[model samples]
Target: MKKILFLFVLGVFFFVPSLSVQAAEEFLYICGPCSRNFVPIAEDVIQELALEDNVHIKLVSCLGACTASPVVEFKGEIYGHMTKEKLFALLRSYFTL
Candidate 1:
């Protein structure tokens, strides 16, 4: 019984922190149906910046900002009127490129 308890504690120590680290990873949400549809741009910039390990890009249907079509959400902040150049700038600033 003591051996089993020790193994369990060791497993928790080794695995729990990894789970929290994964949970803390950043997510970039792009509105797909928006007029600009910057998903491709976002993907390209993420790849170009080599931020695949640090950022996750997700294509969402709508961010409810039609007037601000082509919206992007990063770090819980929403940015509107996004273009290729703007996205590049944002990611560059984010990753300090």
Candidate 2:
């Protein structure tokens, strides 16, 4: 199941010719329902990650991970229980790819 999902995402990336060209500009959206302090965390990640080359970040509303507070989405997957440091690491890794 995991492999199939991975292949599906990979297929999407490979087929989107324009997307492959500027993959870095593609966004890492940190999202969650508005509550607790998720909004601020998402905003902070956007500000920090957007400065990187070919990389952009945004704060998205309602990614259905409200129970996890901070959730991050990129390349069609979502990450929960995120922090600023974790976001930094992910951006660095994805940017390199």
Q: Please give the CA lDDT of all the candidate structures.
A: 0.79, 0.67
**Which predicted model would earn the best lDDT?**
1
TM-score of candidate 2 on Cα atoms, chains taken together: 0.53
Best candidate, TM-score-wise?
1
lDDT of 2: 0.67
lDDT of 1 at 10: 100
Steric overlap count per candidate: 0, 1
Question: Candidate 2: which stretches are off by over 4 Å?
Answer: 1-23, 35-53
Residue lDDT tens for model 1, 1-97: 9999999999999999887834235888887787445767787887887887877888887787878878988877888888778878877787667
lDDT of 2 by residue, 1-97 (tens): 9999999999888888755554446766766354336546545655666645554556777778777757778778887887877766776687653
TM match of model 1 to true structure: 0.65
